[model samples]
Target: MLFVKTVTSFMAVQCVRSRVCHRKFWGWLNAVFNKVDYDRIKDVGPDRAASEWLLRCGASVRYKGFDKWQKDYNHLPTGPLEKFKIERIDATESCIMFKGFDYLDYLEHVEEIKFQRCIYIQDECLERLCRIQNLQKSLQWLEIISCGNVTDRGIISLHLLKNLRYLFLSDLPGIEEKEKTLQILIRALPNCEIKVDL
Candidate 1:
């Protein structure tokens, strides 16, 4: 109990001082401690909520989790959560589905989104993603890594997000004509900053 409290206190100090723990600190603490105890980290839930609140209040940069349980609760935030980001996302075995993410209309402030190794993405899911125009307008940085099932249409829809500044799609499979897909993405998101690796 002492060890957990000490670490939790340390994390709280960092969060209160800077509003986020550095990546190295967050990673180190996860390695040093058993992160499954939700009670010890209840502050994290509020901290995450505060991050969203700060963004809605016009803070330019805000960061929140890599915590295991938080990933389990990645449903859309209750209100307009804009300009904030999820620095580390792991949706490994959670019931988190692409279909459920369509509730993303609530986030008008999310500028950057990263989905790492969330393998359930499919060609059909892209159409669903396309429906959320609010997300596309606010998104600036997007990364989809190791999503093996995403297809050409998924890449093509990147054009709908006009404000996208940097996009990174790595280790995703399906499109055979790499250059053609790149051209299509460029044409679609004419103002976006793009980099594609098949």
Candidate 2:
């Protein structure tokens, strides 16, 4: 009787493992048992918020606006995150705005940044971007399409990006001296391919 009971129990366990226990089942169990209590995470300010955003997104994240990002993350800062390289970002037509370069201090490994149709990006933002450490070595491609406030001065600062190979600055009405701007950029980045629509 004891031998029969043990055999039945073992068979039942094997049956459950083969039929009921799958990847989704295990994942659900883990979430239910090891859920993170975000309420306990302390706010470490805006700089940490940027790091947290990268941590959550890994290499890619898309949001409608900054408010959505804040709301989705529960407004808590995450930090001392693992050194993960973010190679690309696309924030086209999003309400995301940059306050300063401080927000991107941790993303030193980013290679491409796009803000196409982001009208809020201005000369000050471009100036701040030029100040990012190691940007000249790491950043290769940039696109700021339809950013009307970015003038020749703003685009000029990008000449500091030594590794920059491709630049797209289309639909910028403020760049009245388009020919001069293109010439200056061409002289600065001889190997770069630049596309502009005055």
Candidate 3:
């Protein structure tokens, strides 16, 4: 009886240790996927390069004149840079951390972006994204759903998107003052229609 109990306890500990090691490995792998390839950006142009990053991180991108999203990184269309300008992005359940946001710097035509159930999105990521000059002018629709890392500061920082017409925020546990954030955004961008649910 003692030997059986000891073996069972040892197996349970090994299983827990294995799970922890696997989780750490996946986290490290996602960090690697979030790395920006500046050389690739130069060769493929900003939109193509950014699309590669987004798709690699389990996000999807829609081109300027297209309705279907490009989800698979391997199946990305190959052509001239002008052929693939990223217009709308849906980043659902993606691991797009702040480090990969550098790819958004040169994109000139992104209009709509949605982040849903994304674990790696936080205040720094939002702050960095909102600071992009092109995005500030071009973005019209923005949605952040079920992103627990977004606090009042990050939500308030979105006022920088001067051209944003619609903003949707829901299920964000980090947002303490939802009404205050909404009021601030409304005051800052009067033309925008803001919706918030804490």
Candidate 4:
């Protein structure tokens, strides 16, 4: 299959409490650019420019907060995202609702992915995340926080990631089975370091 690749930009604004000035610049970008390669998206109430850079290298993006950027997202160049990185996405709040998990199939070069406050992610997405081993050969770090969806099944699924080095998990809600889950995740990265907060 031919992947139609293009490069696009996405910026977020007014998301964090501390970065008001940064939010202004992105907000301006959102206001001035109409139907540009980049779009202004808001997920988890507001958007952050720090995270939006992930899609700057791609054309089409299956981004969280698609609703906030729906109008802009529709305007993205109709082609494959050339290359992209994903970081610090609220999977439960954004991915599950937006079906952002499907986008992982197109992330051929994503080296790092951090999931935070994503409650919707479950075994199904975790299954897909495990499959990322085939795509992210250069991937080094995977961090997840406050993600109640990643259960033992999801933790066990990570065994295939041979290149993964740093694994960080914190504040996961359904972590009553912490020991078993940690053991499974540790087994996945026999050659790497594993850090977990129980």
- Identify the candidate with maximal TM-score: 3
Residues 74-162, model 3: lDDT tens digits:
99988777988999999999999999999999999999999999999999999999999999999999999999988999988998998
TM-score of 4: 0.53
Question: How many residue pairs clash in each candidate at the backbone level?
Answer: 3, 0, 0, 6
Model 3 per-residue lDDT at 110: 93
* Top candidate, metric lDDT: 3
Each candidate structure's TM-score, on Cα atoms with residue i matched to residue i, is: 0.54, 0.61, 0.97, 0.53
Q: Write the per-residue lDDT of candidate 1 for residues 1-198, one digit (tens) a residue.
A: 999999999998878877444655754543332123234225444335433332322222234442222322234344333323443333332223453453344445566656556545666656565667776667788777777778777877767777788888777767777788898888877777777677
lDDT of each: 0.55, 0.63, 0.93, 0.52
The reply for model 4, stretches above 4 Å from the true place, is: 1-93, 96-98
Off by over 4 Å in 3: none
- Candidates 1 and 3 compared: the better one by lDDT is 3
The candidate with the higher lDDT, 2 or 4, is: 2
For residue 183, model 2's alpha carbon misses the true position, in angstroms, by 0.5
Q: Show where candidate 1 strays beyond 4 Å.
A: 1-95
Give the clashing pairs for model 1. Answer: 82-109, 83-109, 159-189
Clashes of 1: 3
Better of 3 and 4 by TM-score: 3
